[model samples]
Target: MPYAPSTVNQEQSRANEGPEAVRAAVGRARDAAPAWDALGHRERGARLLRWRRVMARRMDEIVALLESEAGKVRADALVELAAAFEHLGWAARHAGPVLRRRTVRSGPLMFHQRSTVEYRPYGVVGVIGPWNYPVHTPLGSVSYALAAGNAVVLKPSEHTPGTGRWLAETFAEAVPDMPVLGVVTGDGGTGAALCGAGVDKVAFTGSPGTGARVLAACAPSLTPVLLELGGKDALVVAGDADVEAAVEAALWGGCANAGQSCAGIERVYVAEGVYERFLDRITLRAPEITGGPGGDYGRMTVPAQLDVVRRHIDDALARGARAVVGGPGSVVPPYVTGPVVLADVPEDADAVREETFGPVLVVNRVRDAEEGVARANASAYGLGGAVFARRGGVRLAREMRTGMVSVNDALAFTAVGALPFGGRGRSGFGRIHGADGLREFAAPQAVTRRRFAPPLAIQTFARGPRDLARFERLLRRRGY
Candidate 1:
C-alpha cells in the first residue's frame, strides 16, 4: 500500500502524462496566459480571493497533507499553511494597487508629454519548490505570479509532491476552466525540464547548489530565474536584551520544523555581559523542546539531511566545541535528530561556516554588540537574522548584513505581507513577498503620450538646431 494513496495516485497519473508533460503543461499555460492577462489585475485578484477561500475551507486537509508529506509537526504545519493563506490574502487584496499603472511627471524638455508605467505579466512562470515549507514557499511564488496574471507550472520537491498536487487541485476548483496553474510531479529531472520548457520565468526555492543548477539550465533558453535559496542565519543577543525572550526566539527560530527551514537560525552570538545568562536560559529551554517521530518537532523529512546534521555536530565537537545540550548521541533514527546546541565553536567549524539545515545551534560569545554585528555579518549566507536589543534594536539590526532582520522577535519579518523577503550572495536573489514580489512576476512597460504640440519638438525629424539648443538649455537648468 502507498503511504498517501491519493497523493501517490495523483503523482502516478502525472507521471503517466509522459516525458513531454512539462512542455505540454507550459503550452497549456501559454494558451491560457493571454485570456488570464486580459482579465486584468482586479479580476485576477478576485479569482485569487476565491482560491484563498477554498484553501481556507480545506485548511485541515492541507495541514494533514503537509504533515504526512513534509514530516512537519502539527503546529509547524499549521504555521506554514497559515503563512500560505496570509500570502494569498495579501496578494489578492494588494495586487490591483501594486500592479496598477502610475503616471510620472515629464521632463521639462518633454513637458508636452505625459509619462506612465504599467506592469505586465511574463505569461508563464516555472516554479520549483522545496520540501521544507512546501506549501508556503511555493505559494509565495504561485500567489504573486497568479496575481500578476501569469500562468504557473510548479514542480514540487520529490519529498513532498503530494502536497504540491493537492494545492494545484484546490486551485483548480477556483478557476476550473483555465489552465492557470499546473503541477508536474517528479524529481530534479522534472524541475530541470520545467526550466528548459520555454517558460518565460522560473522561481526556485532550494539549496544554493540546486539554484546554481537551475541557473545553468535556464541559461540555454535565457529564461529569467528568481532564486530563494539556503541560509545560515544568525541570532544576536545584546547585553541589554531580555534574556528570557531571546531564549524563546532562539529555540523556536532554531528548532522549528526540525530545523529544515532555509531561514532557520543556525548560529547565535551573545554579548559577554549576558552570555552566561543566555546560555543558562537556552540550556534550560532546549530540553523542553523535543524531536522524534512524534514530538514537539517532527522527524527530518529528507533522510540525507540527517548525515549533514551529524557531520556538522561531529566537526564542531572535534574542534573542541562543547555540546551544551545535544551532541553525537542525539541521532535517533533514519529520519529523526534531536536539537543540538554547541558553545565555543570554532569560526571555521563546519557548523558555523556551512548551512547545517538541521536542529542545531552554535552559540558563540562576543565582546559586545559591535563584535556581535561584525561576526554575524561575516558569513556568506545572509537570508535572515534577529537582533535582541532594548536600546539599539533597530540600529544593531541595520548593522547586520542580512535580507530581513527582526528587532526583538525571530522570523517576525516573514509574517509581514508588505516587507520584501529575499537575500544577497549565496542566500540567493530576487524578492518573493510584498510589492517587490508582485513586480517580480511582471515586466515594466513605459508609456509616453503627447499631451500637446511642443514649441520645441525633439523626438522626430521635425527637430532642428533650435530644438537641440532648447533641450540643452532645459538640461542645464534642471541640473541634468
Candidate 2:
C-alpha cells in the first residue's frame, strides 16, 4: 500500500489503496450496476438520501479529516462540505423527475410518429477527483451518478485518500448490501488503472496536463469522459461597479481555499474609472488575509504547488509588474502563501494567462467594461468569471465567454445547484451540476412509436420511386 501523508504534517499519513484495489472496486461496481439501476430512480434516490443522512450525521468527523488531510480551514471545509451535502440532496430530490421519460416534439415529417427521449444511467462511472476539494468535487459527480442509478468507482486524489475513504465508508454504512459507491485511493498509477478498467464513463477533475493523460488512457477503450479541469478565471470590475463590493469579493474569491479553487478569481480586470480605487483597496486589504494554522485560510494543500505560486509572482515582478501586498518572500518556507496582489502585469504573464492556484491576484487596468470583458475573454480558459457593476453587469457577464459568470459577486454560481459547472478551452469540457450534470453520466435513449400508417411508405422498401417523388414534392411544398 502507498501512503497519503498530510500536507500540514507529513508524519500523519494513511495507507492508500492500490491499483488492485481500484480493479476490485470496479468489479464490485460492475456486479452491483444491474440491480442498482433496476431499483428505478425513486428507490435509488431514496438510498442516496440515506447516504446523505449518514454524511450529515458524521459531518464533523469528515470536516476534521478534511482539515488535517487537505489543509483546509474549518470554515472553508464546512462550506465545501455543506455545498456538496446540499447538492446531494438536490440530486436525490430531483433525479426522478429530471431523468424521467418525457414526450418530445415530432416535426411535420414525423407527424404520424410519437417521439420520446429519456436518460439512462451508464452501468458504472469512474470518477478521478482532485485533492483540493476531495469531498465536494468528487461527490458532485458521485452523488449524481448514484442518483441516476449507476454504481460508482471513485479514485480520489492520492493526497486526500482519508477523505475519500470517509466518503466510501459512510456510504457503505448507509447501504451495506450493495456496493453502489466504491472507492480506490492511490497515486497516478492507480488513477490510470481506474480509467482503463472498462467503466461506463469517467468523470475527472484536475489539471489540463493530467486530463490529457486521462483522455489517452480512456481512448483505447473508447470510454467516454467528462473533465472539469481547472481555470484561470477572471474578476471584471466595471466603472459603475461598487468598488467596496468588488474589492471584498476579490479578496475572498482570490484568497479563499488558498486559491486552490478551479473557478477562483486568479486575475482582476477593472475599468479605468475605478481601476485605481479597486487597486488601492484590494492592495491594503490583501496582506490582512493571511494563510497558516488557524488563519483566514489554511496551508497550501500540495507543497509542490508552492513553487508554481512563487514562480508566477516572481515572473510578473521580473517582467515590470509591481506587487501590492506580497512578493517573492510571500511564499513561506513550508506550505503557506498569504495573499499576493500584483498590478501592471503583462497580458502574457503566467499569472494572467495560466492558473496560479494560490493566494494571489493580478489586478490590471482596462479601458472600460468593454475592454475588461475582452481582456477577460482573451485567456484560453473560460470556466468562470465575475462581473461587478451596478448597471451593465448582466450584459457584460453574458458577453464574457465563460461557462458560469457571477454578477455583482464572486463564485456565487458555485453555491447554486441549478447551475451547470464546466468550461471551454484548457478549462476542459462537460458539465457536472444541475440537469446537465445528472445527464453527463447517462445516455439519452430516444424512442419513436408509429402512431398510424404514413401517407407514403418512403421509409420501407415497399415505397416506389413515385412515393419518394411525392415525399420530395411534399417536403419542397412545405419548404422543409
Candidate 3:
C-alpha cells in the first residue's frame, strides 16, 4: 500500500525561514535575557503559572496540533502535553529554593567566616527538541531554563512545528510584556544556527548522530550543552520474573509511542527457560495493538522513518530471523506500521544494533540473569534498561550500565519527579527533570566573607615559625 507522506515537511519546506531567521530570534532572546533574569522568582513563577493555565485551557487545540504535526494518537498527544505541564509546575514550585543561596558549613579554621553558595542564570538557552514527545522534551528544557531566570529560544523538530507554535503562543499569552521565550521552526540549519548563535548554553534532544553535530557546533563557543539523545534500551527478564507481568511490560515499553521514544526498550533478553513462552505471548499481542490518530498507535511522524523501519525489518529477515507476528507485508502502509516482533535475530544484526524508531522488537535468549545483564550492557547506547527480577529488582537495576533502570516495570524511572533524567556514552549526557534539571541552567557561585583573624595566619607575609610548625603537625596528623 502507498504510504501517506508525513503531514510534516521534513526539509521544513513549509517551515518559516531557515538559519538566518533563527539567528535573529536568538539575538532577540539574548537582548531580552537580562531583564527577564532580573525579575524576582515569585514574579517569574507567576508568569509560568499563567502559561500552565493556558496549557490546561487549550488542551484540545494543543492536542490537535500535536496529532497533525507528530501523527501521534490524540490521547498520546495529551499525555505529552500533561507531562510538559507537570514539569512546568515542578520547576516553578522548586526553583526558588533550588537556586537560592544557602549557608555551607566551613571547617574549624574557616568557621570564623560565613560562607554560602548561590546559583546564577546563564543569559540565553537554545533548546533543540525532537519530534517524538515534542511537548514534553522541549518544555523540559524551556521550563527549567525560564525558572532559572534564562531566556529561551526553542527549535522544535521539523516534523512537529505546530507543537512548537502552540508552546510559544501559550507563553506569549502568559507574559506578553516579557520576551521570555521564542520559537524558531526549521530543519538542521536552524538547529545549527541556534547552537552557534551566541547563546550562553544549548539543550538538545534527538538521535545521537545529530547530538554529535550539536556538540561540535557548541564546542567552538565553549558553550555548555545538555543533550538528551537516543537509546537502544533493553529489558532484562530474569528467571524469577513473572512471565505475564514481564511480557506486558516488554510489549508496552517497546511499542508505546510507536516505539519512537528514546527510552523505549528495543531489545529483550529473557532467561533461557522462559524465553520461548515470553516471545510467543509478546508476538501474539503485538498485532492487536493497532495504529492511527484515533487508535492507540498513530502514523509515523517522519515519513523517512518508515524506510528505516522497513530496512531494519528486512535486515532481520535476511539474517534468518522470523517475524512471529508482523512481517514486511504486515507493515500496514500510509505511515502506519503495526507492531512487529522478531525472534532469533542475531545480536550483530542491524535490527538489534540500531535504533529502530518504530513499533518493532528484537528478542534474544540469555543463559541466565548474568547473561541477561551482560547482553543488556553490551549496547553502545546506555540511556536506560529494565529488569524484571522478583527479589533483586533494585540491585539488578543498579547493575545496568544505563543512566536509568526500571525495576519490575518499564519506563517507571521517568515518572519520578525526584530522579535525575539523562543518559551516558552514545546515548548522550547532561540531565533534565529533578534537582539536576534545575541546576542545568544555573551556575553555582561560592561566597566566603572573612570575619575575625585566625589564631595562626596562613596567607600573610608575617607568618612565624610556630605557625608553620603547627600547620605541618596538623597536616602530618591527617596524613596530608
Candidate 4:
C-alpha cells in the first residue's frame, strides 16, 4: 500500500508484514522485560530521562514527520510533541514515588499484622495507537509502562508507521542495551497478533468498534486491556458565559487537527439566553479558519473518513440543519474539508450522536444550564468536554458526565501532566496519564506480616474449643 504526505506530492509504501513479524517483536519484548525491570525505578527513570533528551533534540524532525504522515499543521504538531514530552518527563520524575511500596493500616482486628502494597511490572505491554496524535497518544502509555518497568511493543496506525519507528529508534539510541521498546509496522491484523501474542497487557487508543475487536483478540489469554476510544464530546455554554471566549474555544477545539481529535468538540449546547450571540461570534471567526497544506488546518489523514464526514454534513443539512459557515460545497475533494458549523441540528442526527471525525461543529440551543448539561450527558459517550461559565463553571462542570471537563476553557485538562485522562461508556475504560496511568501498567502486590503471634493461635489445630471461643469474643467486640 502506498502512503503519501498531506501534500500528496510524495508517496511511500510499506508492506504489512503480518503476524509472524508481530510475534517475533513480542518475543523480543518478553525476553527484554526481565533485564529492563531489573534496572529498578531509579535506573529506569534515568534511562527515560535520557530518552527525553533525545526526543528534545529531535523534536523538529518528529514534528515534520507528524505533519507529513498525520496531515497536522505545524502548530498542532508542535502541541502534540510538547504534550508527549511533558508526559515522558512527568512519568520519569514521578514513577518512583507513585509506584513505590506504601504501608497501610492493618486495622483493629489485625493490629498485630503489618500490611504494605507495591506496584510491579506486567512484563511486556502491547500498545496500539491511533494516527491522530500518534506520538503523544502512544507515548502516554509507552512512557508510563517503561517507567513502571515493563518493556513495550507498539503497533502504530498504518497511517503513521514511520513515526512509531522513529520513536523506537530514538529510544534505542538513548539506551542501547536491551530492547526496552520495540516497533512492529503493519495494519490492523498485526495489531491483533500483538494482542494475542501473550503480552502481559494491552493499551489501545482508537474507535469503540475497533476497541471491541481488540477486546475479543485478548480474550483467550484473559489479558487485561486499557482502552481509550472515540468521543462525541460536547461543549456547554452557560447563559452567563463569555460568548466571545466560548466562540474562540469552539473554533480551535472543533477545527484543530482538522477535527480528527477523539476529544474534539463535536456538539455545542448553548443556553437560549446567549445562543444567538454565541452563533454571531462564531460566524465572524469561522471565516478565518482554512484547510490545506500550510493552512490553519490540514487535510483528513485517513481518506475513508472523508465519506463519513460528508455523510454527517449532508444528513444534517437534509434534516433542516442550516450551515452558518461551511456546507456540503466546502469539501475540497480527496481529503481537505474546512470547518462546518450547523445550527438547529436534531439531537438524533448523526452529526450530533456519532463521532463526526472532521472539522465540523453542531450547535443546539438549550433552555437553561440544566438543559445544557442534560443534553450533553444524553449520549453513549462520556469522554472529554468543556463548560464555559463565569459564575457556575465548577458547578456545571460537576454535573457533566465526562471523565475530564475544562471550565471556561477547551482541551486545557490534557495539558496538565498530573490529571488522569480517560472516559466512560462507549468512550472506553481505563486511564493513561498521571498516577493512575502509571499504576495501570503495573500489578499491585500486597504483603502482610505478623508483628507478633497472637495469644490465641487461630491457625494451629492444637488450639481447640478455648481458642475458637476467644476468636468469637474478639469478633463480637469489634462488631464484625
lDDT of each: 0.88, 0.88, 0.84, 0.89
TM-score of predicted structure 1: 0.96
Model 2, range 1-480, lDDT digits (tens) per residue? 222322322232244556677678799899989999998988888888899899899887888888888888889999898889878988888888889999999998888999999999999999999999999999899999998989999887888877877788788889888888877767888889898788989999999999999999999999999999989999889899999999999988888888899999999999999999998888787777888876888988898899999999889999999998888888895555578889999999999888999988999999999998999899998899999999988899999999999999998888777778899999999999898899987899999999999888888999899999999999999998
Instruction: Tell me the RMSD of model 2 versus the true structure.
Output: 3.1
Quick one: RMSD of model 4?
A: 2.9
Displacement of residue 480 (Cα, Å) in model 3 is 3.7
Better of 1 and 2 by TM-score: 1
Residues 17-128, candidate 4, lDDT per residue (tens digit)?
5788778888999889999998988999899999999989977778878877887888998888888989999999899999999999998767788999999999999999
- C-alpha lDDT of candidate 1 relative to the true structure: 0.88
**TM-scores of the models, in the given order?**
0.96, 0.95, 0.94, 0.96
lDDT of 3 at 29: 89
Sort the candidates on lDDT, descending order: 4, 1, 2, 3
lDDT of 1 by residue, 1-480 (tens): 223435347547346233498899999899988999999888888889899888889877877777777777889988887788888889888988988899998976678989999899998999999998988999999999999989999898888887888888888888897878988888888998888889999999999999999999999889999999999999999999999999999888999999988998889999999999999988888988888766888888888888999999999999999999989788776554567899999999999999998889999999998898898889999899999999989999998888999988899988788889999889999999899999999999999998899887777897899889988998888888
Worst-scoring 10-residue span by lDDT in model 3: 1-10
